[model samples]
Target: MSVQSESVTDTGPEQTVGYTLHGNRYLNITNRCTLRCAFCPRFNDEWTVQEYPLRLRRDPSFEEIVLAVGNPEEYQEIVFCGLGEPTLRLYTLLEVATRLRPHARRIRINTDGLANFVYGRDVTPDMEGLIDALSISLNAQNAEIYNRHCRPKLPGSYEAMLDFVKVAREFVPDITLTAIDGLSGVNIPACKKIAQELGVKFRRRVLDVVG
Candidate 1:
């Protein structure tokens, strides 16, 4: 509901459609999400990610999102990330990625991996050509730990997330399961083992580091 931007140029005093960090361009498409994670900055009344205020008055339009990028080739990767889950605006994300594909080096989505559950269908195939990689938040090793941290709205969300990953593997070429290493009861090694079992890459993220 509040609009603010310091890192990237604010668009029409409404929201920040894009921001840069660590050579990557991040798209803040929507502020809605499927899970309410306790560790999320927004949930703690902090909306800035790496100094860029991400609380959106409303989701940006396709044209605004593209305009925010300026030039896709300038960054190492174009990432769909923000204070919210990128997949919550699936069509917009796909459309933007499609438009940027020819010029951008790579396009990735940082997600909570609950698209299938939310949409009630397998939507992974839709990302086949547009998305270059997926950084899914595995969050915790098991359902109990996951529920405690992520606090997904729907029942069986933990299983649903894993199911989404399995189906997503056939479409997206690169998939990496990530978990915050410092979170209580989050076993980094066990999380990595899940990624190994799934035959995907794994990344151990820090507590407050974005991107």
Candidate 2:
């Protein structure tokens, strides 16, 4: 099911289909999300990375996405990410991942850790073999902080996110808890401790570079 790129142009969002950075390819499927963090780039900026507008004009079709991937073998990894939360397009993500698994050395999902809330069931099992790693945006060290920083759409999203991670460990082979490195009031050390407690990896991403 892996996609193979024919000699497509490497410049412009339209030509690249799935956008590329360094050597990694990213799929930009939708412009929908359940959260509106104050620092989220999609809310404030043009949402382009390296002159590639991540703000997709419309949702890409399955065929379009596969074609966008071009040659998945060219990158070290293929990631599900963009202006929107990847889980909102759950089946699409899995379908694309299934399509890319064979050609991609690694496949990762950068997510808000609310797939369970989005689909109202455990979506982790769907990714068992398709995804190589999961990067869950922890955002804050505690519920209060999460509410302030993440600004989730649903009540108890913070608790639900933690619950998502706990279950993710059972199905998703690898998980990484990440927070913006310098978000005001967010204690990076405490976030690391939370990841340590969960027995997963931790990462501190720079807010300015998230796009």
lDDT of prediction 2:
0.80
- What's the residue-level lDDT of 90 in candidate 2? 87
Clashes of each: 0, 2
Candidate 1 global TM-score: 0.95
How far is 191's C-alpha from truth in model 2 (Å)?
Answer: 0.2
lDDT of 1 by residue, 1-211 (tens): 2323433856756377788888888889888999999998979998777667788998888888888887999999999986798898999888988899999999999999999999999999999988999999999999999999999999899999999999999999999999998889999999999999999999999977877
Residue lDDT tens for model 2, 41-120: 77787575555556666777778888878888898878787678878888988998898888899998889998898788
The reply for model 2, stretches above 4 Å from the true place, is: 1-17
TM-score of candidate 2 against the unseen true structure: 0.90
Model 2 lDDT, residue 73, Cα: 87
Note the residue pairs that clash in candidate 2.
5-70, 5-71
Per-model TM-score versus the true fold: 0.95, 0.90
